[model samples]
Target: MNPQASAQRGSFRHRLVRKKRMANSNEHNAAGYLFIAPWLIGFFLLTLWPIVRSFYLSFTEYSLLEDPTWVGLGNYSEILFKDELFRTSLGVTFTFVVFSVPVKLFCSLMVAMALNKSIRGINFYRTAIYFPSLIGGSIAVSVLWRNMFDLNGYINHVLGWFHIKGVGWLTNPDTSLGTLVLLNAWQFGSTMVIFLAGLKQIPQDLYESAAVDGAGKVRRFFNITLPMLSPVMFFNLVLGVIGSFQMFTSAFVITNGGPVNSTYMYALFLFEKAFKNYQMGYASALAWILLVIIAALTAINFLMSKYWVFYESEGGRAK
Candidate 1:
């Protein structure tokens, strides 16, 4: 072959090979997108779209039966100014979050500390302690709680054995919310597991060194264990606050926000407005308010974490 012809043929072959490789790369990219398409579609339709639509609905007057009519900030105004139930529910929810989150965290940490020991049947103990959390939020559990706390139920029966009178737990306004808080604290299993995981990550040398320094178990825990577990504690605190704010099922199924709305959680109020009263617009406003509250609290937690959440990478100081 002539030299010029040979050069042209070689160049054409190189271009063809490059084009083939480019096509294969495009095909792989398309396949990857196809694999993730379901999740993308669900996120847009089920999550993102509802969030946007709810925000829009919050500004309108809409019952399920009627077309939405723009009401500007009327719903928000009514909720803030005219609604006594709104304030009551908000207070109740805040109380629940304040009491339940800390109690649950403390109880979970204590149980986790016990479970972290090298005792016999430790796996079984862990499972037994964790089992309640798995089913604690279920309707069946709520029903059981209601029966247990009833005036003449098993709790009162047990009290009778000691000649002690049992107060109406889920009946009186004073004790009703406390029952829910106790229920929440009892289901500390998941938090316990997280604490256990954090405990396992602490270096044994740290404990040994503290012991060698004539430090007691309590001193070592304060100097070593707590600092190492601060990140996990912060994680659980944020999650617990968020979860407590959204508490609904227990109040709904157990107390039904009864005894003068004492146990009326903000979420329960929102549900009643949307579904029972058919005031979808007001409910949407309440929902958005809840979202804002959760976001703000989470942001504050993150900010405050810099003061308390110790990190080993930062030499045991929060960054």
Candidate 2:
């Protein structure tokens, strides 16, 4: 064939192939959208709609049975100035978050670090540590916690061995919050798993090099491991703080928010207002307040992370 004829034939074939490829690409894109359509629809309906509705309801008096009444900032003013329980609940929740998040993160990070080392029966140890988190927030676990903290329960029984008399863990206002804080700390396995994943992602070469430079385990941990794991630590810290702020199930089941509302978290307060007292408007306001608090705290965390959290690309060499 002549060169011109050959060139024309090649161009025709290339155009046909391109057209066929484009047609296949369109079919694949359509199929991907079809696969995700249900999820998109459900997300919009269930999550987005409810969020928008809640934001709207926060500005109104919206009882379940009655039409919403435009209340402006009345709910906020009422809760801020008049409602004593709101302040108390917020105080309790803040205390819990402050105590629980740090303690839980520490416990989880320690456990993860231990598990990261070569040890006998490691799988068994990991399973044992992780099992508690699985059942930590269950009704059955709550019930068990209630019993264990009761005056005459197993805690006292164990205390008898040390000749130490047990105080009221669940009943005493001073001790009740402490008991829940401990419970929250004990369920550190989920965070531990995340830390373990972060640890595994850390290259062994970093540690080996640190060791070569005569850095002890503690030195290496402070200098290398902690900085490298800061991202995961920050993630768990935020989640733990949020979860602690909304703590309800344990308090609800174990203490019912008291001997004197000592263990009442924000979620329990909101629940009581919404359902038990039938103060839906007040509860919605409380929910919005909680969201604002969480958002503020999360924002603060992100801001502080800029100072403390060392990402790999941010002049921190992760081997």
Candidate 3:
């Protein structure tokens, strides 16, 4: 072949190879997207679209029966300035989050520490402990809780064995919210599992070294275990706070936001407004307010974490 012809033929072959590789890459990308299309569609339609719509509706006045009328912060103004129930619900929700999150995290961590040990039937124990979380938030469980806390229910009947008169746990405003907090703390199984995983990840050498230095079990836990587990703790804390703030099922099904609305969670209030009263716009406003509150609280947690949440990658506290 002539030298110019040979060069031209080689160039054409190189371009053809490149084009074929590009086509294969595009095909792979398309297939990957096709596999995830369902998730993407559900996320946009079910999650993101509702979020955007709710934000728009927050500024309007709408009952389900009629079209939404733009009211320009009227809903927000009423909620902030005019709604006593809003304040009560906000306080109750905050109280629940404050009381439940720490106790639940602590109980979960304590149980996790115990379960981390090598023992007979450990697998069975772990499974048993975790089973509660799987059904904790279900309507069935909420109904069960309601029944158990009733004035003459199983819980009070059990207390009768000790000759202790059962207080009206679900009836009295003083103890109504406390009962929910206890219920929340009781469902610490998922957090326990996470803590167990984190505990396993801590190096055995750290504990051994601490012991060599005459560190007691408590000392080692404080010095070696907790710092190492700080990242996991931080994760659980944020999630627990967010989850507690959005508590609804128990309040709705069990307490019905009753005992003088003492257990009226912010979520339950928003639900009542939207569903029962048909105040869709007002409910949307409440929802947006909650979203902002959760976001702000999470941001605060992140900001504060730098001082406390230790990561091994940073050699101690996270930067």
Query: Which candidate comes out best when scored by lDDT?
Result: 1
Greater lDDT among 1 and 2 belongs to 1
Give each model's whole-structure lDDT: 0.93, 0.89, 0.92
- State every prediction's TM-score relative to the real structure: 0.89, 0.89, 0.88
List the RMSD of every prediction in angstroms. 9.8, 8.1, 9.1
As for TM-score, the candidate ahead, 1 or 3, is 1
Question: What clash pairs does model 1 have?
Answer: none
lDDT of 2 by residue, 1-319 (tens): 9999999998898667545334454667778889999999999999899888877777788767889898988888999999888989899988888888888898999989989988899999999999999999899999999899889999999999999999989999999999999988889999999999999998898899989999998999999899889999999989888878878899899998897989888899899888988766677888888888899999999999998898998686534
For model 1, how does the per-residue alpha-carbon lDDT over 105-220 read when each residue is reduced to its tens digit? 99999999998889999999998998999999899999999999999889999999999999889998999999999999989999999999999988888889889999998998
| lDDT of model number 1 | 0.93
- Cα-based lDDT at residue 197, candidate 2: 94
Each candidate structure's count of clashing pairs: 0, 0, 0
Clashing pairs in 3: none
Model 3 lDDT tens row, 152-253:
889999999999889889998999999999988989999999999999999898789879999998899888889899999999999999999999889988
